[model samples]
Target: MGVYCSKKEVVEAQSSSFIYQRNRTTSLEEQIKARCPNSSANFEDENSHSTKHSSEGKMKCTKVCFICHERVRLDHSCTNQMVKDLEKHMDKDQLMDILMKIKQQVSKDEQSLVPYLHWGTNVALIFNPFTQGLQRTELARNIPEFSRTILARENRIFCIGGQDSSTMKSLPTIFEVDIEEHYRIKDKMNMNQARFHHTAVYDQKYDFIFVIGGMTSNSMGNQFKMLSSCEFYRVQQNEWSIMPNLKVARDTCAACLFDSQWVYVFGGRVQFEKRQLTNVIERAFFSRIDVSQWEEITLQGRQRIMPEFNVGMCHQVNDTELVIFGGKDTYNKQTREVLYFDTSSFSLIHRKSQAQSRKSSNVDEQLSQAKTLQKNYSTAQITVKDFRMPLEIEAPTSPFQIANNLFVLGWSKETNGIHLLRLSLINLNWKEELDFTSYLASDVD
Candidate 1:
């Protein structure tokens, strides 16, 4: 009884011992590293290594031009500039001679041309905004390949793999396009199923592109059905293989490969269920089954993170933050507010925008305004220089949609534009309201 200590005291003593042991462990690790410089495998971030290797491979495509199908001189390649120059002088009469020679020389090359970046906001008021600022642009082209499913590849930004509404089934064609240059489409791979509303994400660990549950049909259909299978596309082998079916049937699901080891699939519609939104997190590990095996995670925030989203589109800004933005809600109205999810707890971030009057038809008249006007308000002839609408954007891409940056508001009624509320995540500030609605009259319905 005299030697006995309460549970709290005992626990505190153990905690102190654990802290001492941890410090010693850290100290030993540093001393050993210094003593035997290259002995330890030294746990490395595999993602960094993979990224370096990927970058190295990228530099090897010496002769391919990612833009305009033009002949570009790579750093070390040898080409006769005189020959190219003289061709410019050759007249249309001799054009056929030049064409044949160029065609013959180029035919020997096997690599396909890279797509260039194309951007257009339909009308003058619209502007191409994403880093992969491409222009197959139409308001109606809302069902983009990249945005549709995991439609993006590693180097490539977005591709077309998800379903097409016209066919009324999942698409068999796999379109791969680089995100940097959003100009053209890549070689299409025929998949086992046409997937629309499926989840697509690149697994660097396995060097494979995996597609999760989506809708499919034998032929086109009037109404759609959910798919329960998972498939993988081998970029190197240029082949397709089917994997184990999902534990649950999902359509319009969102997928992300975070921690370089886990692919989380969540928030999908289950078959004909009207309000079926799942909070299940399917963890596909980087082990042998990176191509297939999945286990459901019963994490604390599964329900909160997934929410009860009906029409939700989410993109991972990074490992820590996954921004779930715009999608038609139960009411069919698009969203502007976003939920920022992390390891500890969820935090709410709000967005705002501001505009100031700068010019007026009559500057003198504006200055002549009543003295009672607030200094911030202005004088006669003063005008709102920038009509920046202070609004919130939900999902942010770059330029049009900054890559994993700003907010993406589907359609902000206030500005009547597809709003991208601008502000640094570090310092929340409103930039400008991007109005795509003006362009919608022609394309987006």
Candidate 2:
């Protein structure tokens, strides 16, 4: 008589719960037979003819579980059960193979959950903040270059115009990096002008990036002509348009956007001048109609920051406040001073008044409100933050916020690699988060 088994019987045998009353010396297959009597079948034949017919029509039965076919059982707790059951049967190498598979699955899951910090340097560096893991990838088309201004939005990092290291020429190149896509970089629309050391600020509401004052020449080795001319890129339109020019022509000026409407340009040096730094603070107001001409902020003696160019690093803390950190002061010495600015309350009041005045047909009232708005720039406040940058770090970039804290990517002369320093908004404490490759600063001009 031939032995035959049904598909349903095999499934039941694999899924059956562990039988506590089973014999301990038997194999798992034998146990399955003990628990599931229907798994294997036998038919007794009284005649030789019946035995020949059964042998000709016999169906093959698979011994392995239908799910996770290599394992003996396919239960809800199969992972743990299989490991325990296989330890005695499997060799050391075979057991290690199973563990490695589990480890890979865990790593894949963690990658999907963690967020990345996309920082642009010669190449884009993607950092896992939680894991402190680092990765680097090249731009889709262009070679990694320096002097580019970086802007982060969502998971994308935009590298604006910068200088070409090899040819010593200013470039209009724009590269967009997607952090989640293995740090993949793709080229975007080039700027209307090629310049470096300019500040790029994004208007979140309008989806426009304003490229402010920078030098027209490469200036890698020598001084270049400073550009007061400014322009902006309309992200949705994929086009660039000229905007109101800066009042003063200068490069390496620190700039940030406030309230999604105001562009503030901090102190910077004049064209071709090394030692002289201007204390000029300019604010440009943006509205639906047009970009109002740039106006210099007027401040009394104690209200002004020390005259320094290229080092006025600041980031917006809120709609009305900003935190400024490490930068060179008037003495041309790098400082660890931290300061906060309470953006002009008068400006906010003027904005509200302007919105209300727009409904009125009185033309004179509208013009009067415009003049009042211009005069309120002096009402802004600046104060020192309780903590400063750690003494070892210097030449910090503008701050970028991740969550509750703000981080600055900086380099140290005393140390070789690039350092990411974090500042807590809650406790005002400074912490060294991670240190990585010096590739970020090695090729800087």
* Candidate that scores best on lDDT: 2
Q: lDDT per model, in order? A: 0.43, 0.54
TM-score of 2: 0.58
The prediction achieving the highest TM-score against the true structure is 2
Q: Candidate 1: TM-score? A: 0.48
TM-score of each: 0.48, 0.58
Q: lDDT by residue for model 1 over 144-193, one digit each (tens)? A: 33233222233343443554445555566765444335434466568887
Kindly list the per-residue Cα lDDT of model 2 for residues 1-445, writing each as its tens digit.
1122223332334334233433356554454455453322322121112222333222111122434544221112333355357657875345445545554444332221122222332355556564456665555545434344444444446677766666667778777666657657677888877887676766656777888877666446344677898888877677788788888887767777876778888776674555566767788988644687999876533334434545456766543556556656656666666555556632212232333535866555554553343321111111112245774444324555543356677656566456777765423447787665554433322
Candidate 1 segments whose C-alpha is farther than 4 A from its true place: 1-158, 162-167, 177-186, 203-207, 273-275, 287-289, 301-306, 315-321, 328-333, 343-433, 437-445
Model 1: per-residue Cα lDDT at residue 164? 48
User: Cα lDDT for residue 287, model 1?
Assistant: 49
